[model samples]
Target chain A: MSILKIDGVSKRYANHTALDNVSFSIPAGCIFGLLGPNGAGKTSLIRIITQITGADEGEIYFRGERLKPDHIKEMGYLPEERGLYKKMKVGEQLLYLAQLKGLSKAEATARIKTWIDRFEIREWLGKNIEDLSKGMQQKVQFIATVLHEPSLIILDEPFSGFDPINANLIKDEILRLRDNGATIIFSTHRMESVEELCDHISLINRSKKVLDGPVREIKDAYKTDTFQIIGNGHLMITSPDFEVLEQHENHGVFRANVRILNQAKPNDLLRYLIDRVEVHSFVELVPSINDIFIRKVKETHHA
Target chain B: MRKIWLIIQREYLTRVRKKSFIIMTLLTPLLLAAFMILPGLLMTMSGDEETVMVLDESGLFEGKLEDKKDLKFVPIAGSLEQAKTLYQETDYTALLYIPKISIEDPKGITVYGKKNTSLQTQMRLENALEKEIENQRFMASGLDRETLDKIEANVKLNTINLSSEGEKDNNAMITSAAGVVAAIIIYFFIFLYGVQIMRGVIEEKTNRIVEVIISSVKPFQLMMGKIIGIAAVGLTQFLLWIVLSFVAVTAVSAAFGIDAAPTPMEQLEAGRVAAEGKSVDVINEEKGEATQAEADEFANTIQDVTQSFANLPLLLILGCFLFYFLGGYLLYGSLFGAIGAAVDNETDTQQFMMPITIPLVISFIMSYSVVLKNPDGPVAFWMSIIPFTSPIVMMVRVPFGVPAWELLLSMALLVLGFIFTTWLAARIYRVGILMYGKKINYKELSKWLFYRV
Candidate 1:
């Protein structure tokens, strides 16, 4: 079931078009990646989804109902520009934010304590945000974003300020939230994380969605019939049916990477390569999400 | 609505807990008390007496000039040159040389000293010489001194305002002073607390927390919450100042063995009565006795002046003060908040702040000058009626007794003005808060006002 469906939503500033007929949906319990480069209308679309801005045209649905003010209580947003009241104590500020998200004070306190304990930041609760390190502040902000246990959480560039260890900690938490039936929409230019964590994604470029699908489906759609083979022998004959992309000697054996041409299947390429070389290993290469993202964005840029 | 309430609570609690807020709140009343009482205390502490040497070559001023506790005049029989030489040698503050001139032309008298004599001293000496010359002329004309003294009696006119209700004693001096004080307090609160709203808005915007907060609350709600929260802070500070100042004044007055400290109006009236007492003393000296009836009349006049404040609509003044204080703050606070949203930093706010500040400043200046001088004048009436200046100018007129219809009209217009500014400001704020890195101008702000929510 789709938790959020943005239908032809558009937003325009005075001198620029921020979002142009952008449309996408996030399924329940799925980690949806909002992928875009800088100035690609990703933040604008996220802002529209968060209701920080009103869409100029079209509608957004939350759980098959039109988005309303009360819907904000169920949605959590952590913007790319991380901010907290500098002079406010960590615990007090988190409680205030949680209450603002429609949690009762007791509920907010209990949840905040649980999150603080889990994040191992129990000692820093009484300290002001200004006294915390950037990574620590990020942890506090993340906790604030999810403190109310919002059903649909949106985190924009959540891992930008985190070190590797803390980033993995947050990643684990995100997956845990997903497993517990919380839908997540995270927007970032980091495609590596998308491949690792996101089940679904919509790549937006220049106010339009250029590519969107499940991670496995998108990788499959962008796959070329290419095969990498490592063997002891090399083929001397070159056929127009297959092109040798590269060949090198590794571990006293020949390894060749080849691309199948014109309607040829991976199996056919493997059989052709096996006939020429002692086929010790055969594997088809799939394009990384990073490569797909760059190529798709560049393709849309040129188009 | 609950989210807005939460925002207001957060805003109010954080600010009220701040060290700066606590310090300022506690410090202002002490400073105000010091300002009110220190000058009078210093005057009483400085008890140095001044001696004046009077050289009457014509001897016409013999025994004419009297000596007071602080000022002593000693008669010196010497030539003009001798008096000048003696003045330098003696400890006299000033030497009065009465040149042997005729009573008709008493213009050549010179007051010589190391430094220039104070204006009060100069006026006192001139008044004494003029009285003596008039007496000498009157006696020479064969008119009895008693009849002349009676003819020169000073008439005190007690002004009373007559209306359909009845005649009420009116003291213009007291009313004007009270009106200006009220106007000034309103002006200070509006400016001070209005800027606080602006700074608070700017802090949220600059820190980039506005988006996170506004995602749960509308921009209008956020602005209203902040403006009202800070206004509450202003009210808390004002109430504390009033109570603390009252306590401090009472304590200081009690410690000094003085009566409860008088209002500014009572103080002014007391000074007038003291001046009149000096003339009364002069009259008693000449007669070699003081009349009981005359003393009773003088005491009654002081009582009347002090009681004049009782006739003033103090409760009404206080109610209107609070209304206008909040009204004026809301009107300007919204504009200040809009400016805060439109600008990236404080420096860029200067241009936008001008249109809002000019009217406030104009109202403050006019409250002191035009409104105080002629509370019933057309300028005062119009300024009091105009919503922009009414908060201040109307408070200046309130103590002077404005008509009910005009007061009601000003109150209605101020409410309308507040609503209008809030609507306009919210429009700009909704768009401006989300906008960044743009050098916004009046044109851009106007465009923002027309943007669809």
Candidate 2:
């Protein structure tokens, strides 16, 4: 079931269009990636979901109900520009943010204590945010975002400033939150992380949704039914069933990449290849999310 | 509402706990006390005790000079050169040489001091010689000393303002002084604390924390929270200053032994009584004495002066002060906050601040000249009614007893003004707070005001 459903949302600034007829949904208890190039209306859509600014011409439904001010309590947002009161003590600032998200003082204190311990940042509680290192401040901001335990969390560029170790830590925490039945919507330019973590994604280009689905399905839809074979094989015959895109011979082994035409299944291609060569290995190659993102965005741009 | 309260609490607590706030709150009263009392203390402490040798070579002015406070004159039985040498030898402050041929024109008489004497001392010496010469002329003219004294008696006027209600004695000096003081305090509070609200907004905006906070609360709530929080800080400081300055002034006055001096009002009343008693004595000369009646009349005048002070609407002034103080702060503070949001930095704020501050500056200047000179004049009356200048101008007219209808009208307009500005500011603020990196001008700001939330 989708936790958030944005229906035909649109936003416009004075001289420019920010979002245009954008529609997408994020399933519950899953990580959803919002992919787009710079200024492609991803931030605008996220702001609509968060209700920082109202949609110019659309509706957003949160948990099967029209989004209202009270629904903000159920959503957590970590904007791209990470900010906390620099002059405020870390623990106090976190508590304030948590309380603002509708947590009682006692609950906020307890939750903040748990988060500080989980993040191993107890030493930073008394220090002002200005004194913290950039990576450490990011960690605090992350903690502030999730401390309220919202069912849906939106993180914009969640790992931009993190070192590898801290990035891994945040990735683990995001997966952990997802596993605990919290839905996450994160926007990032990092395609590698999207492939590694996101279950579903909606790729937007120029304020329009170009591609969207589960990660596996999106890759499958973008695939060309190509297959790679490593065997003592030399397929010299031309047939309507397959086309050899590339072939190479090294030492005693033949390597060939072939694309199947005529809607042939993998088994049929294997059968055809087996008769022509002694097959040692057979595998189907699928496109990476990065390639799909680039190709789809380029396709939309050209269109 | 709860979120707004939280924001307000955070804003108020964080600022109130700052070291700068604490230092300013504690230091301002001492500075004000020093400004009000230190000079008088120093003047009294520097007692002027100096003697001058007088060479009366004209011989007609023999035994004419008299001794005065902190100043003494001694006849030198020698020439001018000898008097100068005596002045140099002794601790005399100066040598007063009266030439023998200069009785007809006293300009030739000179005071030769080691350094330039104070204007007060010089004036005193000149007054004494002028009085002696006048007396000599009067004697030569065969005029009685009594007639000369009578002609020299000063005339004092007692101005009483009469209204349909009754006759009210108006003390122009006290009322104007009080009006100016009230105006200054209002001006200081509004300017100091209004800028504080703007800086607070700028800090939040520049730090990029406003985005985070506004996610959970509306931009209007955030603005109101900050503006109200800073106003609370201003009032806290103002009240503390009043209490502390009162204590400080009292302590300083007691330490300097200045509390024993008669207040200006008491001195004025005493002068009137003295003038009255002189006339009464002249009238009762044939009937021997009228000391009992004179004493009774002097007591009655003192009672009347005290009653006038009692009749002043001090409570009304204080109540209006607080009302206008908060009203004015809210009106200006919201505008300042809006300006803070529209600009990326302090430099860009200059263009926006001029329109908001011009009225305040105008009112401050007018408070001194127009309002104080004529509290009931049309210029003062209208300024006190207009919302922009009313906070200060009305305060300048408050101690002079503004009419109930005018005060009510000004207050109604001020409340309406605050509401209007807050509505306008919140519109701009809601849009501007989220805007960044663009060089926003007045046109852009106006556009932001109409932008859909």
Q: Which pairs of residues have clashing backbones in candidate 1? A: none
Top TM-score hit:
2
Put down candidate 1 lDDT per residue, A53-162, tens digits, no spaces: 78999899999999888899898999999888898999999998888888999999999889988988899999999999999999999998888888999999888989
Best by DockQ: 2
TM-score of 1: 0.82
Q: lDDT tens digits, residues B88-186, model 1?
A: 898788999888888877778988879878776687678778878888898889886689756766666778888776998888877877778888888
DockQ of each: 0.67, 0.71
RMSD of 2: 5.9
User: Each model's RMSD to truth, in Å?
Assistant: 5.5, 5.9
Worst 10 residues of 1 chain A by lDDT: A232-241
Backbone clashes, each candidate: 0, 0
Shares of reference contacts reproduced by the candidates, in order, are 0.76, 0.87
Runs in model 1 with CA error above 4 Å? Answer: A230-241, A248-255, A261-283, A294-303, B48-152, B258-304
